[model samples]
Target: MVTIQGIAFIPQNISKGGEKLYILNKQDVPIVDGLINLNSDSSQANLSEAQQQLDLLWNKLDLIEMNDELKAISPAMAQGKIDKRLIIVHRYIRLNYGEPLTLQLLADLINCNPVYLSNTYTKLFKITPMKYLQVTRMKKASELLKETNMSIKDITTHLGYVNNSQFSTIFKRYFSCTPVEYRRNQHLQMRSIGIF
Candidate 1:
């Protein structure tokens, strides 16, 4: 999912997360649809036009009145002209982040060399595949800790960790708190803001 500006945009099925995001204005729907349709075209000329469409999207977005309830949608269009294989690899990572994933395995998804995949992925996304997986895992762990009542062991298992200590160690390294402490802190912050 791509969150442009402050709006949540789901790139479900095609790439990234599959869950839907917030409600968008009726007028803005066409802009989102246009961009999707524009970028999905692979012809060189249309792809160039798609870049213009993306630019137009930014200009149109500046006029949107954002609110707590706004939502966005997309077909997982990679910005400008991008290698389609990267899109496939990206979507796979998001959908299967819970599984034991590796750079070689991700490269296998496209029958490409691991080194080539690593370099291209890093060049395009500005992060290595393994790093993205770690980030994605941490992000999922954070969501589970704050939003679900799953136990630490259960969460660790769901995240493909072999044991709680390993998960806790990584969690603390990324978040500066253990899973339990993080959950408690989130609850405290929510209560302070009247969310509880």
Candidate 2:
């Protein structure tokens, strides 16, 4: 699953800890419809679904380029880029998502005012830093679920959640499926593609 921003790429794998595992950018860059796996293992009927999705996305992006007058310019160009503040926030989210981090705590760590951090993050990411951290945690948890056999309780404790309930709630909310469901899907996918 992809997030609101295209930069993050969450794979089908779910962590035993109930977080979403992100794909490496080198193997999968954040292009349009990049979530469409080129080698999806999910139990979907077609193994080539990912490739087809990629072709469709590429065509759509191509059409937009062809129709727009900006063809002379680089369609790959990024405009309205984020500032350094957002970069710091993203880094913080990556580094501390599994920890019991608070906004105030992050502000203090970064030597910025909490309000300023909140405002900047909201303006740029369209979500608070906490939300980003939650997403990050979920992503990592999903990865663990797919790649490891650690118990669910162990995953929850590792992520620093108060208990399994909190972890389940967040995991369910984001994935629209329980951690187990996500894991099952990943297992089926892996088996279908002979990854297991």
On lDDT, the leading prediction is 1
Model 2 over residues 1-196: C-alpha lDDT tens digits?
3432234344444757443344544434545334444344555554456646645554543344233313322232345444455556667667767678888988887788999889877765556888878876886788788867888888888786889889999999988898888889999987886545
Runs in model 2 deviating more than 4 A are 1-86
lDDT of 1 by residue, 1-196 (tens): 3446544443323343432234555555876677667656668887788767666554444334222112221222334445679868876886788898889999999999999999988876667888878877997899788867999999998988889999999999888999999999999986675434
Which candidate number has the best TM-score?
A: 1
Work out the TM-score per prediction.
Answer: 0.60, 0.56
In model 2, what is the error at residue 77, expressed in angstroms?
16
- Location of the lowest summed lDDT over 10 successive residues in candidate 2: 68-77
* Candidate 1's TM-score: 0.60
C-alpha local distance difference test of each model: 0.72, 0.66
